[model samples]
Target: MISLTMEKRYEIGLDSYDRLFPNQDTMPKGGFGNLIALPLQKKARSNGNSEFVDGNFNSYEDQWFYLSNLKKVTIEKVEEILSIVEEREKEELNQ
Candidate 1:
């Protein structure tokens, strides 16, 4: 998984991946020219758009839509939220 700040997630979620992590095989010969470069994971397309999900949609992992507008990337609670969502899903399915 990519270890990116929450702000990055929002930007990417809004089809801004190309804006941040430009489509390049490797770092520019010299240096990125004021581009918002990021180390993207192999799963992420070199140049692709993100799936637009609604903020209230909780089924999607990473919860990008739900937390996209956050002022700060509160990564500290990612696992906690995931765990809680998982537990809720399991309980609902078992009922």
Candidate 2:
């Protein structure tokens, strides 16, 4: 058997959803439209910040990206994971 690979280009930024909840971060949390909006500040995480959720998602709009080829793989992975979480939430709600 043979398999083919596909690439997807997505624009990540601050996304607004119908629902809102606690972000549980040092800074205020808002709707997350897309992740990987910008490069992160070279800093560490504490009680009030995220180790991975650096920079602003709005800065990364209109750029094409793939899951496999990214400078910051952590950000992409986090985005993918969050999307999965959201998908599960919706599925659970529907069910």
- Backbone clash numbers for all candidates listed: 0, 6
| Candidate 1 lDDT (Cα, 0 to 1) | 0.50
> In candidate 1, which residue pairs get closer than 3 Å at backbone N, Cα or C atoms, i.e. clash?
none
Please give me the total number of clashing residue pairs in predicted model 2: 6
Model 2 bad stretches (over 4 Å):
1-73
Best by lDDT: 1
Q: Hey, what RMSD does candidate 1 come out at?
A: 15.5
Each prediction's RMSD over C-alphas, in Å, is 15.5, 18.7
List ranges where model 1 is wrong by over 4 Å.
1-20, 24-70
Tens digits of per-residue lDDT, candidate 2, 3-92, equal: 111113234323523433332222336544233432332231223233332167323322244323456659889999999999999999
Per-residue lDDT tens digits for candidate 1, residues 11-91, read 444453444344443555767432432222322323433332456842444545545655764676887898999999999
Cα-based TM-score, every candidate: 0.29, 0.25
